[model samples]
Structure formats: structure tokens, C-alpha cells
Target: MDHRTQLEERIAHLTRHVDELSEVVARQQSELDRLSRRVAMLMAREAERELDTGGSIPLADQKPPHW
Candidate 1:
């Protein structure tokens, strides 16, 4: 039809798309935050387990070639 009408239609379509994307982004952000907290908790537990198991591996002492 007319230029102004075409422009209004395009604007409406873009606004609808942007609103949908905003909702999807918000949901993804929430999921990411939950996963981050879970990961942090698991890391803390792993660290505690490592400490309870004496933290690190021990290195054996070795002598030189000479008897």
C-alpha cells in the first residue's frame, strides 16, 4: 500500500520479534544462573573431598646414578 503503512507493518513485526526474543533470553539467563550455582556447589564439594583425601599426590625421592 502506502509508504507509511508499510513502515508501520514492519515496525509491528519487529516489535513482536523483539518481545519474543526478550522472553527467550530471560529464560536462558535464568537457566544459566541456576547451572552456575550448581557448578559452584559441585566445585566446593570436590575441593573439600580433595582436602579430606590429603589434597595432593606425594612425590617419591630418587637418588643419582652413583651407588
Candidate 2:
């Protein structure tokens, strides 16, 4: 094959690879976003449960041991 033809083939192959990688990255981003939201929801629920039980005051409001 001619040099020009070989270069064209290589370009096409690289383009296809780049497109596949982009799709994989997009899928991973979506999954990460979903997991983040789920974690936030779980944390909120736990905080509410703590309040209901009156287990303890929030950490920031408590006095240090030395006080």
C-alpha cells in the first residue's frame, strides 16, 4: 500500500479507539455521580436517627476534655 493510504488507516484506527475510551469515561462519571448522591442520602438519614434517639450532642458543641 502507498504511504498516504497507510497513514489514513492509522488515523481511522486511532479515532475509533478515542471514541470507545470517551464512552467508557462517560459511563464511569455517571456511576460516580449516582454513588455520591446515595452516600449523601444515607448520611442525612443517620443524622436524623441520631437526633431522634437523643444519643449525644453534636461533636462540635461538646466541651474538650481539659475544660
Candidate 3:
């Protein structure tokens, strides 16, 4: 193949690869956002449980047993 033709093929291949990678990254970002929201909700529920049990320390502020 001619030099110009080879260059064009390489460019096309790279472009496709970049597009595929972008889609993968976008999917990961969406999944991460969903997981983050779930974690926050779970944390809130734990805090409410602690309050109902009459625990004064917020779960986040409490030190570990080793401390």
C-alpha cells in the first residue's frame, strides 16, 4: 500500500480504539456514581440506627476499638 493509504488506515484504527475506551470509561463512571449513592444511604441508615439505640457518638467520629 501507498504511504498515505497506510497512514489513513492507522488513523482509523486508533480512532476506533479511542472511541471504545471512552465508552468503557463512561460506563465505569456511571457505576461508580451509583455505588457512591448506595454507600451514602447505608451510612445514613447506620447513623439512624445508632441514634435509636441511644448511642451518643456519631459512627463516623467514633474511634476504632484498638484506639
The number of the candidate with the highest TM-score is: 3
lDDT of each: 0.81, 0.86, 0.93
lDDT of 1 by residue, 1-67 (tens): 9999999999999999999999999999999999999988887777777767896622122345584
Kindly report which residue pairs in candidate 1 clash with one another: none
Candidate number with the higher lDDT (2 or 3): 3
**What's the ranking of the predictions by TM-score, best on top?**
3, 1, 2
Per-residue C-alpha lDDT of model 3 across residues 1-67, encoded as one tens digit per residue: 9999999999999999999999999999999999999999998889889989999977956899999
Kindly report which residue stretches of model 2 are placed more than 4 angstroms away from their true locations once superposed: 56-67
Candidate 1 residue-wise lDDT at 26: 100
- Which has the greatest lDDT? 3
C-alpha TM-scores of all predictions: 0.78, 0.78, 0.87
How do the residues 12-67 of candidate 2 rate in per-residue lDDT, one tens digit apiece? 99999999999999999999999999988887777677778895764444579999
Residue 38 of model 3 has an lDDT of 96
Compute the lDDT for candidate 2.
0.86
